[model samples]
Target: MGFATYQLDRTNIASALTGGFASAISVNQNTINLGNQLMFLGVIVLEIPSNVALQRIGPRRWISAQVFIFGVIAALQIFVRNRTGFLLTRSILGLAEAGYIPAAMYTLSTWYTKEALTKRIAVFFFGMFGGSAVSPLLGAGLLKLDGKGGLSGWQWIFLLEGIWSIVASILLISLLPERKLEAPEKTISSDEESVSKSEIWNKATSETISLRIVWKTLTNVYKWPHFLATACVFSTWSPLTTYTPSIIMALGFSRIKANALAAVGSLITLPVIVFFAWLSDTTCKRGLTVMLSIVCYLITLIVLRCLQPHVGKWSRVGLWTAVNGLAVGYHPIHNAWIQVNCKSPAERSIIVMSATAGLMAGTQIFRSDETAEFYPRGLLIMIILAICGLALVALQSCIYYVRNRSNSDSVEEV
Candidate 1:
């Protein structure tokens, strides 16, 4: 629900609902991009600290507080009269939202084993698409209320969505469960038992931030290899989402039409994601499924980039739908792929935040104001990143293959 509100605002540019904002604040694409960068920068900077707070304070209080704070921030966006206020609110919202995904995933890990985790993550992660699926249509409808009560349509969008988030946060505070922290060491083997126990004892005894724990995670997380690979793979899709509506508009659709069409594209992806998620779980081949999803994205983007201005409208829309459809499935599969490989709660929390931060970093590369229409440069950069991501996935898969073979050999010899 928090994400839905976030997406609603994030996607407003394509809906042209931000025309009011542009006029009110004398804003431009460069200013908007700076606001976006600030938000993600907040997320990147605060992610680990926020997760540490989640560990200390507990999810029910910490997560719900964040939701409530962001809800307040969302409502306050209406009062942002200048670039400074705008950037301030964006940074606060990013900070407010920073730990949410990892927190939720951490909560999920507590309830489900690795094998059963993917579908659960999918159900939760799908909220992003659900919010995205509704945003364009919601913005389009809200845009019609531009003149009501002396407020602009964009203002209405912010006000109403903010109201929704506030209500949702209240309910979330009531409904979210608090769990007791267990020693994550219990899940690992005896070979590393001594170190795991010492770490667990320190965490349990010292509620304060442990530099040792942080350093341990920082050093060993890099050794995982898949962590950076996952970050790279995840980063490839992050920028595409923020400007989806603009991309559609660039394909010759009017602003409102672009939003409505973006809605249609999101709707198309929902079931595709659900199906691929199910396939990933049942087949027990998340790595392969994620790789295929990326391949699909690469192909769609290449086609979209190569298209002529004279291309049929439906053709462009079809490609758009296909591209987003493939994009949605990657998260659940990749997330599950990462989760199962991680041996403890600490590793999962750290890696998830790092990967997500990598994604936020990728979004900074796409500048909306750089072009009035179309994103040739951005798309080309994305294509290159996608290919790099494919290479990383292949390398990770090879590593997995080698590790599995080595493990089998050891077991057989013993």
Candidate 2:
């Protein structure tokens, strides 16, 4: 999903920011922002399976369903030209991709103890870096095909890229393991696993998440201050995924050059993505790792708004590069942290899906108003969110301290 966005956003911005093109387009900021919100519509499609399918269909059948669905979506892009066809293809792809992130993290939860979950999450989220790194390369390559065959290369870009996702879905199923739960005995095979996931969610989740129980998990999710704080951090971090190239253009770079520089930052994240995951796993300091990452992000926003306007191309690239690498780290920790705090698997799925939904509900919180001008004002707002996140982190730390401070007597006796 991250890779798809990287290519789509890069290509979209490349076209939008080109001087001779799109000068006649007269849509309001709301419309363009609405297009961006289509991403969340995409998210909704993806999260449905994650929230409802894993336990309902089970992993084996659901994954097999996803693989079959992936091929169909890819093939649809092969012949479709109308908006309806295109939208249907994307919405289906969205549903297929949606099952991945939260599902992967939740799957990781089953693998490691709580202390080790954060690192696993960081490794999983390295896809952002991987996607970012590859997106520009893909975009820059695709831009070369722009005028070929009287069809926009962007169309071909979509068609060809779907293959990658389809192939990936197949390979990944072989790698993902399904553990036997502490429930009634039933045999699970590769083919049956996806269907069984739905069984877990439907037949199983009834205990904690029936129509009556759903509200308990749902309402309790928002009752935590940490979840709200984390949402703020995530909502801000989102633009880095979808709008980094836009932000770079705000600093007066050409679209292609801006995207290429975005790649530079994308490249810088590789080591951090690997090493940070390792540290989070080893240390169990998921929240602390996130706090540090957000600090980098806060500093990046400051640099983009304040220093970027004044910096030379050489220095600007350096700053934006740092921004890309640092900005992505906050998410893995938050993804893991939410699950860690939840008392049950049912609640964990609820919190992950709900928080992600809130992140998608960005139109209400930080409405994207500036279409042509990359609004630096948005950065100011997000910075405040980051600070609030820090405050929440501090509160959590103090809570832990107070709870454990009195343990010295028992430790000494032992």
Candidate 3:
């Protein structure tokens, strides 16, 4: 699903430029940005509602159904003949996918104890980053199918990507077990394991939507400065996967090469991401791990900005790789941090959704079509954001350290 989503977003630039889509819809340069706006807006609007729905429906059925529905919608992109149709399709895809990441987080929260969550969440997000890593090469190859069977290359891209999604949906629906009432054996500590089934049932059942429930969830999520900070931090990175190929192309790479080259940053970041996740989990220092990545960005972006255009391909790739490598660790670390801190199911749902919405909000900066190729403005903004993120990590780390010290002091007094 992550792969399909990235495939769709990553292909938008190429699709517009070469897939005959621009001609079909009489689209201007802003058409792609407009599509992204509508899609992200849909995601924002439907995020909370989608989580509510997820609670009512089990994760297995709700998530699988979302995959299948969006898969169909994605494949339907081949049939769109107008800008309106394109916008409508993207909007629907967003609606289908709105809560998916959060829902996955929530599902993980249910299955794993807080202490054990980072690595598992890291693995889960590996799918997302993995999808991002693979989509460009895959899309580049599929572009060759253009003009086949009365379809353009972009249409083939959408069709093939959607077909893969449909197959994945089928596998998910068939293989994923129904939501169990308790965490699987050994997933939680003995104390948590000993939680009475009735008490667990009550907690789950009590989470139904109400005005008070919504208010409480919102307030709880809002009061957590770390959550807000993390959300803002993630927004800066969220659109990178979608737009990096265009940036690479601006550096003199061809469309196919640009797309294929885009994969390398994500590919290189995979192990680094995993290792940091392990470090964060083992040391219980997620803030430090995330800060290291952000500082890497600060340095990389400064150097990248200094480098003039027409730099060698390897130089460009090397810089972009550093940027992605330093930036990609945030998702898993931040997500695990949120889930670990948030115990209530309702609270976790709202936090995840709100964080996602914040990330989407942050992506609005990338909506500039004029800057699509180089994103000078985006780079400056991200550099500033990296500094801000560094501060937030510091604040969060201080807060965590203080809280831990206070707990220890109280224990000693007792």
Q: Taking the candidates one at a time, how many backbone clashes does each contain? A: 0, 28, 1
- Pick by lDDT: 1 or 2, better one: 1
Superposition error at 246 for model 1 (Å): 2.7
Tens-place lDDT per residue, model 2, 170-274, is 665665457434444355787776344434443432433344445676565333555676677766645565566656666687666666777777777777666
Q: Report per-prediction Cα RMSD to one decimal.
A: 4.8, 7.4, 4.2
For residues 303-352, write the lDDT of model 1, one tens digit per residue: 88798345787787777777666665576677667766665656666676
- Tens-digit lDDT track of model 3 for 314-367: 797778777876676666776667666654666666666655555566655565
Alpha-carbon runs more than 4 Å astray in model 3: 1-24, 181-206, 221-223, 367-373, 405-414
Checking candidate 1 for backbone clashes, the offending pairs are none
Which of the predicted structures, 1 or 2, would earn the higher TM-score when compared with the native? 1
Instruction: Please give the distance, in angstroms, between residue 216's alpha carbon in candidate 2 and its true position after superposition.
Output: 3.6
TM-score of each: 0.85, 0.73, 0.85
Better of 1 and 3 by lDDT: 1
